[model samples]
Target chain A: MSEELAAVEETARRRGSRPIVWLAWFLLAFFFVNLAGIVFSAVVDSFGDNWFGNWLPQVWTTHYWSDAWHAYDLGQVLQVTLIVSVAVVIVSVLVGVPASYALARRNFPFKHAIMLVFLLPVMVPPIAYGIPLATAMYKFNTITHVQIANSMFGVILANLVPAIPFVVLTMTPFIEQIDPKVESAARMCGASTRKIFTRILLPLLVPGVLAASILVLVRTVGMFELTYLTAGTDSETLVVKLFDSISGAGIRAPQQSDAMAVLYMGMMLVLLVIALRFVNPTQLVTRVAEERDA
Target chain B: MTVAPPAPAPARRHRPPDPRAHLSHRLAERGIDRTLWLLLPGVVFLVALFIYPLAYGLGLSFQPLKSTDPLYNYKQFFTDHLQRDTIGTTLRISLPAALVNVIASVPIAYRMRGRMRGKRFITTMLVIPITLGTVLTADGMLKFFDPAGGWFNKTLFALHIRTPDQPVLLINNYWGVVISLIISGFPFAFLLILSYLSGIDPSLDAAASTLGASPRRRFWQITFPLLAPGLAITFCLTFVLAFSVFPSAYLVGNPTSTTRVISIAAYEARSVETNDSKASTIALIMAVIELLVISVVLFGRGRLYRGSTGGKG
Candidate 1:
């Protein structure tokens, strides 16, 4: 009786879902087509000599890429970007992984409050917190005579605000998924806490840590507001440089901006591909939803 | 006699040292074991970098640089039409964009909820915008929606909906920022909603269907209510994202008038005008508004079914 009912329901579902499925496909295609068109337009413009009212540029050239690289001082920008992203990734992972273990494994007082504190940066938009953060950075610079507000150190510090929390958020689920029995087994075998962490947990946590670090690295690379607020002239990252080229008061060619944009997109795409290779697309956000519910 | 009595008492079995006597044991009792030392660096980092600065900024907002009145910055912001109107403009752009993104994401996320063959490919494709970030998306929008040769205008030209002379007014307008927000925000909303939708057990729907409920009826009766809380959260997240839009507004919208959002106003106050106090005040206002919206949505979520919908996250 249940089998017959299930069969009937399955047929009805398949029949009823056709239009809805088509609509879903249409929406997906529409979205991707627009996305591709947007990226394609930038790519073509970056290589094109001039674009007018036409389907494609009449001429194509690589000069814009060369021009943008030199004109924007992209070598220095890329160097700064690399330094900041790497520093942020290392620091966030180092700070976040153990904290994730604590949060995941221990039932502690004010656990929810602590989680909220960690989640605040991820939940709040950057500018909401960034303004105050930048102000404090500038103030610190004046008081301590340290170049924190606009220096590379300042940029790393500001980016860490979000990056560290992101690491914690991503790593918590990974830690939770590891069975507590394994740790207990090691403990019963006379492993000290330090040995348990260094020998057992560390090995188990490699993939999670790598995924977290790569995600943080990508986030740091693209972080604009905090970087914009805190970075000095010499500390600007690629995204910030890209923004300045677009919005700054200067007589710059459109193609040069397009070229820089294409370069920025390429770097982000590379990081994203690497990130997605290790981390499932769903894994990126599911943990966050779980965190919210918890 | 006293000595004999003491000896006799000493013969009683000695209690093993109380486990709680050790600091580690006591801390463990309170859920603050040695393992918690690992949390120290992150907690300290956040306190110094995130919490302290925000607190300092709040304090700074109360200290006007040029005015004796503590409320001077706040007053000036409210009194100034340009600055005050930004609250409205930001809302105008963000509210609808967030709503649209959340609404658009739900149907698609529902359709794509369970195991599907191309789910991974589709999800990865949707995630492109999120990775693209705002600046690139704005650049893309500029070129793709350019009046002279943008593909959008070109499409309009092909469709005869518009001509080269009068392309769809997408870039550097109110709508442009909203569109950019939707494009960047929809992917996030979809990912979030999909995760939430997948959290609901399929058996409930199957049960509903077995009782002879139609697909539409089952969705409204069972799935929609279950999804309400997640939708509220998705809305709040997207709203916050759109509300704090800066790069897109600067790159794609009319910054001075049409879409001079609160963040841009705060930026100008801090950077352009070099008034940190005023910037902090505006930043506080922005945070307040965002919290207000979030709390309202969450309050609505509280009214929904509070029990677990069955699938563990």
Candidate 2:
């Protein structure tokens, strides 16, 4: 009876471990197919008149590489996207840092109420915010010098809603982490108010601020929703070019568009990895995941 | 407890005066001036960017496009060209996708708990969609999931010798959108759960295991109960994310009036028809509904984690 029981327990342990095996398989399946598709796209585009066909043919060339450059509006799209991203980062930090600290520190009345005010940008999706932001900008003729629609500025303005939240969220933890005792020490030394901030607090906040800025850059530059709505016909971003090309030709040259897509992906991935060095990426994803597991 | 003992005074100094001494002592005790100075930039930034935007947005909502007393953009949105259908569509797509994402995320998250083989690789793969930009993923799906030249139909035909002309799975339809949602939405939920999983007290789990409970029973009794709050948060986040589903749908979802959600409707109102007031009203309406939903869920999640060792006692 003891021997039989030992065997049964061993069998149960094996059964318990099966889910991990299955998950490994499931992830592999998803990744492999996409990998294959990319390779097939590369090889087939080289060989045949059927531009986006399933298989390779006898005749092949590097036509798509050149085509990818011009088929999509690669040159202009990247410029607009980079410009919008930089602007959003500047504005978000300008807006979010002070707001986040006030919420994190301070004991004024309506304190919680003040924090609640910032949550609107976070709760509502860009789709919802984009309409009013874009429309309001349009009313003033300030969208872009390049005919407003499809311009870089529109995307930057619309992106502010989400980017501001990113700043507030990231800055809250860092600001709240400051040791209050240090500030008290400065006071006892007879330091003037301006002297204390300029000399003390600002220096300490450098790492925190750098972390916040990189975070804002990575997401804001890559943002898509508001850009799609507000950008002019001629001012395609990297995403717009990618979307137009693979889905079939728009003004973006199709063959060259693939190269732009690959380049965009490469740039974004590099930035994300760099950002990860500054801040924890898991903080964004696992806020809820951690809750479920705990 | 940690404060320094009072400093030694100058040797020749006389005893301090009463009122001046009293007033100086109080200011020194509270350190209010020093604290405010440290907090200035953050305070100024919040007031200008966050508070201003929200107040302005609210004001914009009430303002009318035309003349005088609270004009009728709200009225215009109600009457506009098939514009009213947007809310219904956005919620229909958003709600289902969010729910699906939250549910699918659990299994992957469970597998990821405590670090097993290939875990980092799996996590990276899951987050690829997020980094790749929503547009690229949707575009990739468009290239691969189409009926004729796409991967799904092509694969099925190769394996089973089925009809090649049959519709491809997950392209322009609601499922396509859900696939995108699951791909992008799952990583954050999975990571959040994974962190929470790591934080859970192993002793409680050990106690449950010793009590003759099976693994599944232990999870339900010990893990799931504690995890309820986290689940609620994940649901709200995933819902908000899917709620704003535009680029993926617009880029990949074949632009039928059927898939065009409220964002598209609001966009058309302002851009296509040139009506800022109505668009503002519509956007405000969206903000109100989403905010209301988020508050109800967040408040109901029981409590924020209170025992964490991050703060001063």
Candidate 3:
């Protein structure tokens, strides 16, 4: 009798969870289907001759892709993107890693205040600060004749505002996870500070640095507001190019715009794939959330 | 090759020790060592690029080009109907979208919190939007959700949800921005809430179940209270992101009027009108509004939960 009752309870529990499990799956399916459809449509529309009011384009061609490439000067745009992304990655890591080591391994007066200053750029959206930054850059250009605004140099600097803080935030937790005894052991071996950092810490920090780099690379590519505010004609990245193509009143087919967008999306997807290989997406959010809780 | 030191060095000791080395020793005692110098470059960069610009902009806002009044820019923003109504328009779009994103993610995240098959696959799929960003999403959304010939309408028509004569007009209107926000913001809220949910002890839920509490009861009575603080933070962050809706409002929605968020106002003021003072004023206003909303949520969160829900985690 007891066995039958327990069996009945088991069935009841399963039945209770059945609808929720189904609902979860249904939502996931719904979201992915829409996402896939959205992305796929861009690809299909770019190649379509004149797709209108149909499930599939009646005709397709690669002409738009070529047209967009030349019309948008995408070759230069892509090169600028690569340059900006790579520069931001290297510079941010170089500047941020040592700061992260100091922040993680020591206690100092106003540490939290310093951290809040670093955190502000990441927490606040770019548009809030980008306006001021761009305005200041322009003013500086007029006064100092340095020409930072509306130039490639300006774009790199604007991108770095958030990127450096992000690197520090991500790397701090990674440094904390390493045992301090490792550093002590190096010290015991009579290794100087610089030598310990170069010989001991750098080798152990490769995975963390790689993860931070890829994440920053992906962000800098997609960064729009700051770059848009600061970039000049010659300095525009692929994303800025795509935006101009869309909002521009140029007499080009919509398919051309779609083609440019596809190229941008393709680049982003590749970078994302590489980033995911080295980092667990959840691990990134966990640290930030834990910090908030503390 | 050892050399003996000079006898006692008493005469040299009359002068103060090297001032630089003495200062360094004091600084190091306070946890500022050579390693701390590494923080200098980043701090200098931020101050130069972020803080100084913002300060300059703030000062500039007070000195509008045409008006002598220090408050003229602020006055103009509040007085002009076109500019003033944007506060309402922005909130109308951001609030519902953020609320829906946070509220919807709670249940889904709750169910998916435990170890499960294909977890990484689903998490990665959700996180893809963060990297895809507003630009790509907006571009794709314009094509995918186009009323005239988009797949969404096609699907609706095929499913008999609506007649072919009447397709859903999602794009180029208010609903378009909301949908775009949900698409991008939902994943972020999900990721944040999932982390918070996973931090809770599972034993509490098991104990509740053992006590014969129904699943629904256990969630509402136990988990919901514990999860409130996290939900507040997730909502606040998501709300902030949603409030700064610029690219989507431009690309997917009607940016001229229906989806004219404050960011658009600031953008037009700076880029179109070339009025740096006016633009700075609007940007400051946007930041103030965001801070107000955030502080209110956080204050309520403080009242809602005073202490941590104890757990091994």
Candidate 4:
């Protein structure tokens, strides 16, 4: 019995020290350390002056933030971003909610095909379609004398393609969760169709609408390729302007770009936290990918 | 007697007949057929914005300038070394980075599955890089992995891993862009894998262990087979995400020819060279490649699980 107990203890010890387990822990630790290190470096460098050849900055200053703010015309950029984001959200909801209701409540021909049509915009990379879209916008602008290209309206329109689809897909699921009988009951009470939608359906769907809008807000703020391709001089959003400053062919201070990046990061962090509170990351990913499947 | 008359005959019956309710009643009598009209605006928006642009782009790709040859732009893309190399460059960075991210996420996700302390917190932290977007991540990489005065080099120097003058070449090359892709791509891959792993029933592993199977044996026989489909899906999604990398490659990479992804080529062809035809050609080619990769992954996934009886050996 004593010999058996000793052998079991030895096996347990060996298993605990297995190389694979150690490697797993080590890699996890490395991942966290690297993640923390990179974020910290950016934050520190944004505030540092002359941070070369040293482990830490010799002097810290808020001058880089000011420089990035003024040099990038961030005030205008923020206003444009706000306008574009809000416009995209409002339009997406207006177009998406009704469509979502139809998709959820009605059985139509080529319903699956229509859902797939919505899926294409989200699945494909923006750059693939953005080039031609931008070209078309320019052509449209030239012909119609309506500044679609290189203008705020153009950016908002371009964003609406994916935003509307996203709203439709997310809202379809929400609409499906609600009982259809509620609308029927309102109709039975001699209420009009519009009244049923406004009083009975809208109140119940508000939470879903809010969640969808918040998500669209996050996506619109982070969208780069389409906006970059279509935006004009005065319509550049924060991401586009940041890209221009960084990739532009000129000698600029690294700290200033770092500061701008920090600002972008801060904004995204706030938006994402609010988003995560309302939706699960896993659920969001699967929803975006498998909505058609669902 | 006056109360009995109640004035109802005059006022209640003739109160405009409630047009709102009347209209609603008429609509209800028509059934839900009008719901198709609700779908009109969205369908029109997609067709106008999404389908039209893609179709126009495809059409534009075939029309070459100064030549009637429909394949002129495509032939040029294949023959030109700089343009042709973007495909190779994109694959080289995307494939390995995506593989590493998906494979690395497996063990960590396996360990993280089920009830655990700080799981929510750790998962939230993992998602930060993804939300930070590629531009910010590339900027962070530029600062943290700087060759001259960066902390990574300084730390290596302090630890006697290299001479003070000879810091490791981390940025401005293939590895730099790969690291940035990994940074942004890993969070997405990790979250995906975590969700996949959580879907797997833990009782299978527990049953195997009770039957005297070691942890490795249980994972290989029970867990891995079940996880293969999710892994393939995760790999494909991450591969697509990495394959489309543009800003990060330009920022942290030697963007001249070494890291000129297809998107960069498309951008230049349209913006710099004013050649919309060639730009469309490159974009179409990129789309084709992505579709082929996705199909191959799906095919492999179908094959892997076809013979198994619901993941049973």
Candidate 5:
């Protein structure tokens, strides 16, 4: 009996290591699959005529990169994307930070409702709202004496609609996490609400604000549907530009398209890393888990 | 999502007076100051630009498409092909995609949940793909899945399958869209859910384990119930994001075989057909379907729609 028990124990302990090995192998497969997908696309783009057929691009060259650098002319779209993303972040922060403060510290009526409205912006599909948004932009041209439909500002305003809710969603918790006693302490010491908000509360909440801002920036830069609808080809976004380049007026341009795709991925990867440093995806992921495990 | 928050009532004191109220209350008690209300500019901005545009779009559904037509744009929309498909297609894509994404993402999300080894690397990799917009990822998929210089071709030929002449897999069809949605959509949704997963009270988990429940049982009885609401919200949000597929279809799809989301139809109705009212109707129809899905998510699963805001202090 003792010998048999020892064998069971050994097998159980030994069995544990195999599953771990299997798991490691599986994860490696996922990584390989995804990485191969990306690199495969990148490597294939370096060739011509052999886009989908060649085992290896019979002719590989860095010509796509050198040639691509000059022609895509992304300066304008980059500027527009930057301006809109930054503007949305600033505007969302300015608006969301204060509201989150009020929501957090104050015992207000309709608290749930307000938050719902705050979240409502992102609740439905952006495209669903975009049709009317396109029209609204057209109408705003007459009323504001600004051509919002085809301009960057219109896109920014549109961006804010989806972006602000995210800010409120993220920052609300950060503000709530800070003890109200601290806010009260500031008040007792003669800090105005504004002073308290700016000096004490704001400092404590920078991480949350930064998270919200970075997320807004990333989403803003990647925005495609609204821009496609609101902004014409004349004021096309990089995504739209990429789309046009591949599927525009002529036959498909795979090499150029892949190069542009690489360019897009590169820019976004840089932004995401920068954004992730301040606004770790952990917090967002945590929120998901909490909601699911609610 | 079900009910709006009640109006903010006056803050009440517990033991008569909390010391700080006197310094601030008297001056501020009489109706909210306009300046104090400035916190609302963002709200108003959304209302005006986002909400207003959506409302304007919705209202147009009641009006006829043509000056001579006497019916609501909505009535005609449902009667028509493009608008009819708007709801059907939106639901078709969102429901199944949400299901597939949720299913496919679970093992990955679960593996990513705890302090497992390789968790960080897996997470970083999962997340990296999403940083690029749908357009970029969809476009890159072409080279990866394309027929000529595509990666799928290269790999298969290397493996001694059929020649590289035909190499398209789910690159630009319905399956392609589904694949694209899964790759781009799941990480965002998974990350959202992972945060909630980590937030499950450890006490509840501990107590369940102490009761002699198996891991699967504990998860279903204790963990999964708690997760349902968060999952619902995540599902709806992701469904919203995914069904509104625009850039992907525009970038990689074959005009006939590859692409045709409702948004594309709306764009076509406006740009190609020169029918703005029809476009608005299509948009409204899409909104209605999405709203219905959200409602089902909120109501069917015995879950409450609480914002992921509050506490953790």
Candidate 6:
């Protein structure tokens, strides 16, 4: 009697757990299908000559790709994008690396408060400050005639607002993990400060610097709101231009817009792939949060 | 080598009373800290670009349009229907989308909790939408969810769920916006929850099972309680992301009023209406709402995880 009851209980437990296991697999499958479907649909539509009420496009061509390229003036857009991204990366690293070193090594007054100040730009959405930043830029340009607003300089400056802080936060951990005694030892060997920084510290810090710069590059490319608000007709990045192509009150074909999207996606995918090689996405979130809390 | 060093020191001591030495001595006397100087460049940059602008925006929001009523913009934000609906519209979409994403991710994450094959692959796939961003996702949604000849309607027609004439209205509506938000928001929420779940020890469940507890009871009694704080935090972060919806709302939904979130309202007030003060008012209100929600979630999390060891066992 006892054996029979145990068997029956075992069977019931299996029955109860079977659906959950099936559900997990189903959810996984659903996630793949949904993500793949969205991405593939865009790619296919971009090349499709005509796709109406069909599982596949009736015809495919590369015509829209060229059309989007010239019609959107993508050459200029891409040039501006590269220029802005590179400038933001270089300036942020120059400004952030030393600050990160200081933050890692020093005990200072109002350190937590200062850290929170850096955190604000990142934690808060860009739109919160973007309006006023744009306004100030416009005001500055009108007053000084320096033309920072609606220019490439303005866009780079705007991108740097978040980029610098991100670099500081990410590089602080990298700097912290290194032993400070190494630097002191280099100094004790009668090396000048510049030699210590250039010869010893730079080599050890290369991996972290590379990771931070790659992330900054990715962010500058993907940043939308600030660029959208600040970019002029001549200075729009890929993302801002893509937004214009979609809603710019022009009578462009949807396929052409899809093509532009595909281009944007291509650029982002390459950068993201590179970034993932250096940093885990899970660790990325935790690092950002941990810095804010600390 | 040591004799050469001593000869260099003699030359420096006799080098016409070095001006740089006096300057260095003065600087040292004034307590010119190197670390402070090192931090100055970044500090100046952030203050000039970030802090000044945020403060200016707040100050601008309080300025009166007529120079008579100091509270003009604030009053307008509350009294004006169009401005006021933005708050309601933003909340209506953001709250439900965030809640749905959090709730839906729980069961899926719970099921995938233990060591499983392809977990990394699954996570990578999930992160694709986030990388794609809102612009790409909305663009794809426009094509996929088209009513007349889109894949979605075609599938529905073939499935006999709806006739050709009665195609479902998926895009340019409230549900369409909500669905798009979910598509983008779910991946992030799922990643957070999965990471949280991984931090939980598996032995608790094993112990519970050995004690004759069923799987369902083990989950509810042991796992769910421990997961509450993580759930609260995940929901708060995702909620902030959803609340700031701008591109998707504009691209896929009825942005005039139904899906006109506060970001849109601020954009219009500043760009279309060219009213910086009103835009600042809207932006500040949005920030306040986000902060309030986050604080509430944190407080609740403190209560939930107050003495619990988070199952480090």
Taken over the whole model, the C-alpha lDDT of each candidate is 0.88, 0.64, 0.86, 0.83, 0.68, 0.82
Candidate maximizing DockQ: 1
Per-residue C-alpha lDDT of model 6 across residues A84-145, encoded as one tens digit per residue = 99999999999999989888887666778879878778767688778888988988998999
TM-score of 3: 0.91
Alpha-carbon runs more than 4 Å astray in model 5: A1-28, A43-52, A66-71, A142-145, A249-252, A284-294, B1-36, B65-67, B70-72, B160-168, B202-207, B254-259, B303-313
lDDT of 3 by residue, B164-204 (tens): 78889888899989988988899889988888787787667
The first chain of model 2 has a TM-score of 0.74
* Candidate 6 chain B, poorest ten consecutive residues by summed lDDT: B6-15
Give the CA lDDT, 0 to 100, for residue A181 in model 6.
93
Candidate 2 or 4, higher TM-score?
4
Instruction: Assess each model's interface with DockQ, reporting 2 decimals per model.
Output: 0.59, 0.32, 0.49, 0.37, 0.45, 0.33
- Which pairs of residues collide in model 1? A150-A232
lDDT of 2 by residue, B1-313 (tens): 6999898977854544456566756554443334445345544544544455445656776777675557466666667656667777778887877776666666666556654677766666556566776666665666667677665667778887667766556778777776777667767666666665666665565555556667677677876766667778788988898877777777666456767877666666666767666666777777777777788888887564434322111
Which residues of candidate 4, in runs, are more than 4 Å off? A1-19, A105-107, A179-200, A288-294, B1-32, B211-213, B304-313
Residue lDDT tens for model 1, B27-53: 666778877888889999999999998
Please write out the lDDT profile of model 5 over residues A158-213, one tens digit for every residue.
77887877877777677766788887899999999789878987688876777777
Residue B101 of model 5, lDDT score: 65
TM-scores for the candidates = 0.93, 0.78, 0.91, 0.86, 0.84, 0.86
Q: Rank the candidates by DockQ, best first.
A: 1, 3, 5, 4, 6, 2
Q: Per-residue lDDT for A123-223 in model 3, tens only?
A: 67789999999999988899999989989999999999999999999899889888999999999999998899899999989988998888889889989
Q: Native contacts recovered by candidate 4, as a share?
A: 0.59
When candidate 3 is compared with the true two-chain complex, its DockQ is 0.49
lDDT of 1 by residue, A1-294 (tens): 387877787688778778887887798788888889999998999999757878899998999899998999999999999999999999999999889989998988899988998988987879989999988988888999978888999999999999989999888988898899999999999999889989998898988888888888877888899999999999999999999988873578888999999989989889889988877776665553222232
